[model samples]
Target: MRMKIAAAAAMALTAMPLSASADGEVNIYSYRQAYLLEPLLNAFEKETGIETNVVFAKQGLAERLEREGRNSPADVVMTVDISRVNELVERDLVAGVKTDTLTGNIPENLHHPEGKWYALTTRGRLIYVSKERVEEGEITTYEQLADDKWNDRICTRSGKHPYNIALISSMIAHHGEAETEEWLRGLKDNLARKPQGGDRDQIKAIAEGVCDVAIGNSYYYGNMLMDENQRPAAEKVNLIFPNADGRGTHVNISSISLTKSAPNRDEAIALMEFLTSPEAQRIYAEANTEYPANPGVKPTGLVAEWGEIHPDDLSLQEIANHREAAVKLVDRVDYDG
Candidate 1:
């Protein structure tokens, strides 16, 4: 049944290609939700007189692309997490891209060295502490989460989740596998409850007194504040950008890649270049409430209020290389058990 549903969805996406319209269009396979990307695409269309057609899915685009092979209609692939981007590259589904616009606007660390993929925005893995139970300057670094004092007081999603995996991968980059394994075990032992739910649920647990501290993405805090029921819980916790004193906070990105068999190569490159432009970056940043990947564009709205984010200097590619080790360490500690 699942396979049938996925096949039907893929067929629906591929049946309509960019050439269906007189105006040049770029077909996109996106993991990002429609509501978040529609506005940005609309801006792109208005600016360049190009049409944007998107097939939004939660998963399976990579497999679908590989199955479709050379005949695939997908011109661009956009997704969150370095693992997903690397997955596309490893599958040989995306091609290398290089342009003065892309290379100049984006930092080298945030894009693929071979130009196969580029990041559009970033979000940090932040600590959310109950204002009443935790004090200022009490918790300043991720290493402190392993301390015995936080035992029975910390909350998070499953350790196997990609967001956590990327964070753990960064830990492996900064500290060796053995030390990272020890830290993973210590953090697991400190859990307030069996790991469950999304990042927002962790913050909600903090407000309910089920736990005093939770780990979640920085954008989730802003998202919660925009929601009425969630705003109450969001208001109760203060965000702590861990490792601010040392390497800076552990961060992840939302990124884009060009399909290996892109039929509309020129149009796809145009959309990719537009996405990295300051105008489009500003619109995307404000609409999605994420920190723009472009250094020239400052974060606005609720994100700006969170204060300056000094992102960790580690290269995303380096962190991605350690993902396998990180996943093994999670299981070694039985982190989700």
Candidate 2:
């Protein structure tokens, strides 16, 4: 319980600077909330005798790392979403790390080929339909979101959101830019309202009878179901794994990278390897209701209750490559409007 957690802003102003190479200590800059990481980090510390320090932020951790450069005390950076992790690589803030343990624990497609970053857990971009309105078999694929029959019945968060962007990127990977663009436009035309709020809001919209369908991540539904206030709304919708019979559902990940300037390199790598272990993977996955990236670890609790996920085999690298195109398609279609 010797963990130190600081808000990014507070750390900048008041905290004493850390040594570049502190013994038995690993520093982290994370976009993932501290609570979600607490159990995993605490476990790492107790077992390995390495103290953990974390600076948590919703935004700007990457830029902060860039600013601090080689002198930065950060060892490992943890964050969710493909675009964010790819941004770290694009900015040249992380170093390549390859190990037998890492390779054995993580799927090839879930980690960078060059070993710059590795995914810890995954969550699918799921379709949510009103239990009362949409038929179970009526909308089974993402392609059908554009169908005329569902016009004025669909709801979603902003298309430019990373989750939607990744989904669109996957679409571009599978169908090419032109076809993806057309699908985006058709989806835009089906919106029940201007894109607004988080994924949970889309589920709420369905509950309130504002729309019959929505797009959201699997964990959001699980989270909502766990909350008494939101469970009623969550219960109104059924989770649909789109394209389960074909290309499979598109999934995004929560990932970790070793900073280029990691002073605690050995401990950092140990932390990474430990995270992929069955014990840690189970803790990480269950904490957020996400699928474990370690293939040996199966999702439990509510996530397991949802059944198996056949994730789209399209490489995440390809999804990252198509992200710019997906953003362009979103803007081109005025999807937020």
Candidate 3:
């Protein structure tokens, strides 16, 4: 019966309009790459016999979904960063979902108050310092990036980037807007070079001795170590979970949402629930060297070797709320200049 339902769903997907939702099929529009999601999707298919379809893009997915409106074929939307996911909520593009499985598997701080979205995995905003040039305890907090001892020693990507914006937003939540502005000015004054590249480039800059410390996501360091060509550079730096002993490291998430126009709501919910399962969480996190959002699932492989992370308890929504201020502060300080 399951196989018959699955086959029928697959055929319906092929024959019907994109907006048609079938009983045993789920459709996903994702900003995350296809390769990362394949394993988890495959497992979901095998277990529940639901057919899955995915459209992967780097940008414009939110716009696409907005244009499609009620006819949109997207049942689930997946992407990284709080700002992107929050955009779905702000635009009313995604509907809230409440299920015991989802709420139970994910933590309170990680999900929306009304369940508009749920995070699947998290990556820390890490500090990477040249292992040889910087000594232990030399730099231990995000606040230290502003200290005079590190003037012309720090490297980072554009402050306007969503990742940095989210981090800056967290700072505002902890400190008032006035104090965060001062901190931003200090951090900007300390830049080794005009912030010009992605997180990986900052790591590479460290390897080339262009800077002594860089701000980056934890997964990039792990991914670089896994690549033979990048391994040498990666090995040159030590990863720091800043503020670990105090407020804990700031972490960003990769998350999923149920589109307001979900054609196959049941199948979509099934897939969402499956993703939070221990089996799916393990496969999902290990694929990209990320920490599982499901706290019961432990980090493995190279991610585990880096040691445990104590994530900041600040609510992601609180961080999202301050995004505009963070961007303004970045520009006000001329951080990229």
Best by lDDT: 2
lDDT of 1: 0.87
| Number of the candidate with higher TM-score, 2 or 3 | 2
Task: Tally clashes: model 1.
Answer: 0
lDDT of each: 0.87, 0.92, 0.90
1 versus 2: better lDDT goes to: 2
Model 2 / residue 275 / CA error / Å: 0.4
TM-score leader: 2
TM-score of 1: 0.94
lDDT tens string, model 2, 23-128?
A: 9998988888888999999999999999988888777878888888998999999988999998899999999999999999998999999999999999999999
Better of 1 and 2 by TM-score: 2
RMSD of each: 3.8, 1.5, 4.3
> What residue pairs are clashing in model 3?
none
| Candidate 2 segments exceeding 4 Å error | 8-19
Candidate 3: segments with Cα more than 4 A from true spot:
1-19
Model 1: colliding residue pairs = none
User: Which ten residues in a row are the worst by lDDT in model 2?
Assistant: 8-17
